[model samples]
Target: MSTSKLFDSYKLGPITLSNRTVMAPLTRNRAVAGFVPNPLSVEYYAQRASAGLLITEASQISQQGQGYQDTPGIYTQEQVAGWKKVTDAVHAKGGHIFIQLWHVGRISHSSLQPNGGKPVAPSAIAAKGKTYVNNGFADVSEPRALELSEIPGLIEDYRVAAKNAIAAGFDGVEIHAANGYLLEQFARDSTNKRTDEYGGSIENRARLILEVTKAVVKEIGAERTGIRISPVTPANDCGPDSDPKKLFDYIVDGLSAEKLVYLHVVEGATGGPRDVAPFDYAELRKRFKGTYIGNNGYDLALANKALAADEADLIAFGKPFIANPDLVARLKAGAELNKPDQATFYGGGVKGYTDYPTLAEVKQAAE
Candidate 1:
């Protein structure tokens, strides 16, 4: 029964959120066989159904799009069936859910790729990072540059994934253009050395993501399509852009033109400092005319402050939601949160995934 704007309902595109808190997409890397969502995921997400919106862990659009081991995918009927249960469980509790569509590009190892082939990226240059594969972290395989002919097929993959998400009963889908993934790889010049139509100039570099966004919007409606972007994050060896402000401003402008439902922006580094670089986030906010979701390192105070200042329409909390299934209730009551176990974060069973006790449970135990 808090009076803060953080507890208020929000109208996002076509749907109304119960509160302004969003559970950000967190990769647990716990998919079962055929890259389907782990059966436990339904319970895991249902436990967190009190959030205003729950964005599922980044699900690969196709086998070629996978990077980390054991993460879920959305391309096949089996995978769609797995997610339907998750969506159904979330909806039964009066919650809204969106699935994040992902393509990891060069952030993958050959073992995770189709036929043990090389991962694909905007260019052939290898990212100086590692991906979890075969239950261990290994250096990302050197990627082959995507042929221009392959671009259409890639966009098609996103479109089909969006369609699959809807079929799986997701309220919407968030294109994962953030965190140096496939789309980000194309958008950032540091990783995109292609001299083709998709490289060099800012517009050229921005083409692939824009096109993918357009395709997803076309497949689904714009009101059902949102996107996530991390402008300056050096995650997965995506080097700093020459002019991040200019680049993201142009990108945001294009996304605004598409009239996306919301623009989820990761402020500063992915999981690191907020002031990792100085880029005016307000500019992107001004450019995009839809709901704005602010993410990364946000606590209750910051969320309240951002909403009060009208900096964001919603606040997406990552790790907090992991250990606190009842995050909104805990925040409303100002209760202590359960700390997440880092040891079992990546790939695991239900211990770290769904066993976190809620505040009410803790209170009952104490009593």
Candidate 2:
């Protein structure tokens, strides 16, 4: 019944985390106008500050990176200021925070894009699904392929965002290369149909992510930057990777060369359309020598098993962290957890976000 591994302190770059349970970035779409993190976000994050680490939800690096309404941005002065509050709150609670940098790429609709411009991707192909817009989920629009000249600018955007994150008092930043986002659009072959330097070959396709990570590391220290990848996930409009294992190996090797703080891998398809890709996660865990955070539909038992088997150095929990702010304590004490209310997951008030009962509350109820 020991949970020492989960409770042990670990070093991520220059910072040391008190535990190995990380709060995974989750989209709540609760920001204020102009995509600023609201006070509610402050309270929400502050409430969950007991975790070893907390990664803010996917935040756009620029206006064009936005896709959904109300999701926060990291590009503007106002947004940075807003995020500063959340970082301050987490820090005051002795918790480490990392902002997740994101760009929706072709998954966005014109309504969501700034200046009504076309959503840009590696190819001009449109995603096969709907995008959440002002009204609701609407059919996705065709995206314009980014010219080779545009790639460097996009990488620079990430660099600036990483710098902004550090300015906002965050310990580091996690590049959102997962869940069919911009970086994933480039990593997967189906969305990247270009014959240019950024397409066709695996190294060519992974160029943007590698360059972006390196640039961010240059802006901040490599020890303070991490990248999240979902090699098996097909969320949004991304399709099956032609050779996931090879593509990811090239990516992991390139990232390992940077000596990043950690690599967050979404191990399986949680609810994404695609079935989980056939590959050995143990191979990935070995390939990436740095700290490994395994995510996607993991329960307490499964997470412990992964740790015991040396399959992962850390465990990132999404929904569980949402419903149980004191998730680490619950696991340590073997307490039953509160179930998450899906309806209040996104764009809602504090009921589902902050009202979840902790172990103390459940024990009080029993009394």
Candidate 3:
């Protein structure tokens, strides 16, 4: 398979992708009241429906999973109806989308948790960051360490969320085990100090992640399940694992058994220096033995190189998709890429969200 080109179609499990360009899950914080996907979200996602696969922004499995303000959830009937509209719009545009299930763990503020409960995690440590709330950033609240008995309930949350995603009409679902979230906290030893079956060794630290993966897979077949892992990403403050290669190699090896559709990996720190740590993507890839979508700072040339080298089956683009709705076409034609406006990247009223033009519009403006 000569995978240098982005326009080539590829079979990803049950569905065929039009191209290898994947729109990575990005948090736009545009959900309406009740944490439901809004009409604006429908337009926002439909605009970039050209991707081979569209992974929606991390949707909280429960209110306790929410870390940011106005982020959508898949926990309620209203939320499911809202996502149905978003997924329907994407399908109508001839695209495939996966909902990313997330839990913020210690990276959340009390205001974001249900009834102002302290965010829960594998340990009581607090993440060194601020969570966006009501148009401003608030200090993250310290979390309560999960009692051994609570593990079952947390895993059930993921299972229910997977079912909700299917009910909401998503073609598949991605478990967000990456980037300093709940799953990652359990996987990383930096914050997890529990001395039980869920912590201590690499396997124990990764217990929750693998358990959640298995539960979700049971609810929505392994073929419809994918997971993202950030081995060394220090973003949101739950990273720089004590032994990233050991921890992730164990994770990748364990994941090989679940028969997951794909394993999304951020080569290094999430959107940070590639050499921030000593972890190796090649090593992790070799252990996984499945479809891999490599992410973090991939451009056309890098993506092409990775594809040609068999480094990744698919390449996920994040910030680039924000500024270029027709990312696939632009990469194919080698056109000038639009610069993204950082001010409007987080919260906004469709300025940087859906206002980006397509390739044709860019060509016309120049003419």
Candidate 4:
């Protein structure tokens, strides 16, 4: 228990991590107007530079891909320059960072989209929920179903975003294919109602993700690329398939052919409704041959167990990393963790962002 397998270093493509503890991408909604990262973001990430690998908050790949206000983007010159400050800060602390390129699909409101247009999705279905916007929460609009011909443009957005991430000085890029995003919408049968080559059968449903990954790997070598998948998650108003295992099996198999750097899988929501379903995390670990990062509700003990049992090559901690900037150090020393302030999680200043103390500060307090 004292010496955990999670503490071991592992090679992720061309980069070597100090350990297997990864900081999961978390949206803080603290970006400036026009979705540009600010100096505060630079400070926020640099403070957590001890994580083995840091996956930045999901960043929009295009204007149409944006689902919320103040979330950073990667497709523009200003945004790329903005993110460079963040990457530079993390690298200065000797940390490796990956930008997670995202497209929200149906989980969006018109206020967050271009020209006040409807959100775009695999189908014109409306997410049965509300979305956070600049003002506050708003009902999701009926999304416009993308045409068959329009698919390539979306794929190209991801490719260009990967290139932009590299230009921003990111060590790599992770395709945000999970958590009910655009790619997940296509992967799940319930959301994708198309009869064309991109829908219906498992292979067809998984085609867009494969194409996007191929394009990204082609744009930037496969060694500098990673993908994330949430097989059974119903977050962000995503619908489930009749057979999730069959769908994901084909998806993972297709991605394996690319020989990408790693696959980050969210088994289910840690404490949400999705956690009620039965899932096989161990099976997913076996299915993905590359480095596997397991996310959701994992503590230091569970992370160690997963690593020792070969259930995951790495562990991604979300909220824990939010409050504890020195998450890796705390995990290694078995120190008490800082409780995250849910009130300040979404949109905030320095209160819950970069003010958390490291173990050194706490120990000094006692003395």
Considering every candidate listed, which one attains the maximal lDDT? 1
Q: Which stretches of candidate 2 lie over 4 Å from their true place?
A: 271-275, 365-367
Taking the tens digit of each residue's C-alpha lDDT, what string does model 3 give over 61-84? Answer: 999999999899999999999999
The residue pairs in collision within model 3 are none
Ten contiguous residues minimizing lDDT sum, candidate 2: 270-279
TM-score of each: 0.99, 0.96, 0.97, 0.97
Write candidate 2's Cα lDDT for 258-361 as tens digits: 99889998877854322466777788788887999988877787888888899899899899988998888888888788889998887867889878988898
lDDT of each: 0.94, 0.88, 0.90, 0.88
Q: List clash counts for every candidate, in order.
A: 0, 0, 0, 0
lDDT of 1 at 93: 94
- Among residues 3 or more apart in sequence or in different chains, the pairs in candidate 2 whose N, CA or C atoms overlap within 3 Å are none
True-structure RMSD for candidate 1: 0.7
When 1 and 3 are scored with lDDT, the better candidate is 1
lDDT of 1 by residue, 192-219 (tens): 9989899999999999999999999999
Candidate 4 all-Cα RMSD:
1.4
Candidate 4 per-residue lDDT over residues 83-198, each given as its tens digit = 99999999999899999999999888887788999889988888898878856888888899999989988999999999999999999999999988899999898899988898
